[model samples]
Target: MSDAAWPAPPQGSCTLPASVEAEVAILGAGIHGAALARELTLRGVTCALVDKGEVGGGTSQWSSQLLHGGIRYMLTGDIRQMREGLAERATWARIAPRRCRWEAFWMPHRYWAEGLAHRVGIGLYDHWGAERPGWPAGLSLGHVPKEAFLADPRGVLGPFRGATAYADLMTWDRELTRDLAASSEAMLLDFHEPEGFEQGDGGLKLLHLRDRRDGSARQLRARRWVFALGPWTDGAMAQWFGETRKRLRLSSGIHLWFDAVPGCERPWAIRRPKGRILFVVPRDGLLQVGTTEREVEDGWVPILEAEREELFGALEANLPSLPWREMLVWAEELGVRPLVAATGATTHLSREAVLERHARIPNLTLVLGGKLTTARALMDRLATDLTGLRCEASTTAPLRLWDGQAAEIR
Candidate 1:
């Protein structure tokens, strides 16, 4: 990795503020921070946003890339959450259709005993969206594992059994984040690391930031701070919220990639027999396969695994006939998902993210545990809280900065 993979803020942009008109500073340029920045900037709030790494390069890049409404919640039979999630999921399709669009996912229908409950679940899923007779509203691909493939030996689960097709959005999540950051009036200050903070009379004050590329240092001042740092949310919380920062449980997930089959169509979120969902997500050239969750105690950093046997094991379990013999055309990657754990079922953690205000500091707000598909709606909630502000977003079409694509902050 280039030591300078991330760029420096525009020279002289970080000048220490003598006194600011507004009182809000948002720290950490992950997805949530970028969403907040766009919302606040459009509201004309005075704010300074900072990040330790490249904007949208952290967990945002690691997302499963599903702009889902909440199929997971549907399985739980929660109408309210399912309804809310579907609404949020649609917002992405509307705003960033280029970066986020709709996809039809398949839930295997075999194993009648196990899937009996699931059939009711997806029927509710279709009903929640008011699914149309055939699809979009709700479509069912007729069941049946293909006799040829199943008889061939390598086939694992099958359409031969059948699957329920559900609608969800496939998103270029990382790119959407970069676009959101660009939507903000706040200066896009990337590559600067927060050094420390001090408990001052006015509130918590950021001491300084270090430039990772040049070894130079600078200072920036803001009235208040917001922590949207993904899993790093914990560290920022511990620092400003006293030693009493709320707890967050983090985990790592991995996905494998394969070239689209001879003519496999759009994205397909396949439900495996083991309660794990592997996304058969489609991109221009490749299909995204993956995701096995492993818990991590501290989550401020990215996960790196040169060889993930277990991650692949799950994929192999799902895609039984994958041809390792073909050679030269598959990829595997793993990243951490920062989820707030709740009791009941592991996947049933509150889909609705929680937001809390700092007891000591009135302006600082901490937004925790949100799904990628719900970001725009999260901003909508922020707008609702602003009171008296028009909720209409700007005419600017949403964009996502995949890889290192850069955009001008307006």
Candidate 2:
């Protein structure tokens, strides 16, 4: 039915969705869309979130699992992005203690000179957190042992140098994803993949959905549509002429899990000789590890044994005392980071605000690369601009996620 002929549902109340109506139809039920769902519902907007698979089943679950400040981001001096992210980090920590909790991350420095540079950088972190509520202060470590992390063999060792501790939060992405799905009255359909759709009347967006579970198909119409589809968003915008897949550059990252790592529960960051930054994150009960950033062409590879092999070697070389062979077998997972790049920028681009309306889809908005800490802020901006009905976003402050307390919000 044409939008004008179809009966319109009341703005504040949901009427059955016509087996397909939504005030806001957000694509991809991962963190990006999930968080947006929560905020929209809190604002009383009727939202329908659709995912090809499970909610939070995407890379959101496979993240480095850090709700960390932009320490790496700070390296580029993206002040506006850093400050805003710190705020969101604090908020996520406050609300979601179950799945999101604060933990201290250590980056042990070997060279005295490099230590000095890190000290200055950490000082900036401390200063940044001083104005914010949830961030913790960076602590300086004196001399330590080679096997200090013997408790967690997957951790950094050697050089007997001091370590610095900075504040960061980690969360169970899946639990948080589930929490968001539960918190919203918004209809979230899993495995109901979008087949495609034509632009609707009056700038409305329509989607042809296939309920993969039952092999049933239907069309969904919405006043506004959101493409928070993570990495796949690059291809989903194909129907539009003006939009280019170049709008986003996908990055591949890998992580290994092992409980064998010896050390304090405090997470630590280690600088590899290759100018790469790696983290040995302590999550829930598993020792999670990861992350080399490399650009991608147009393919999705599940797990790369090469990445695991190289990363394992790196960890073993850095910490000789650990049983790398034994610990490496614990568990390994992989995923891609949906990175949005602006003109003349790369994935290493500044950790800044990436809220932009789709150049081609007038009724659609796209949220690009952002820190786990900044997702909420991104949601707030999205709601303010697209809701067409201006409502203040108190959410940027009220919701907290550290320790995964946000899971409880659901």
TM-score top scorer = 2
- How many residue-pair clashes does candidate 2 contain? 39
Prediction-by-prediction clash tally: 16, 39
Per-residue accuracy of model 2 over 1-410 as CA lDDT, tens digit each: 11221122222322333367888988878787888888888788999888777777766777777666667755666666666666666677666655666666677777788777777777778567653344444433333344554444434355635666666667767777767666677786666756767774456467777666556666788888887877666666664433454666767778888774445466778876434578877665677777765666442555666777788787766656667677545677666776666554344555454777755567877777665567766776787677645445444434333244434542
Q: What's the TM-score of every candidate structure? A: 0.79, 0.82
lDDT of 1 by residue, 1-410 (tens): 12232445444433434233334567767777788777777777766667777778777877887766577665555667668767666556556655655555656544676456556776667566652212243333323235523443323443325455566666666678877887777765567776776567767665477766555676766656667776667756676454554456676677667666654454555565445576666576776667666566555333355335664565565555666325344765555556665554444456466776767766566777776766666765764575346556632335444434544221
Position 279, candidate 1: lDDT = 66
TM-score of 1: 0.79
Model 1 global lDDT (CA atoms, 0 to 1): 0.61
Give candidate 2 regions above 4 Å deviation: 1-18, 131-157, 239-244, 273-275, 342-347, 351-353, 388-393, 396-410
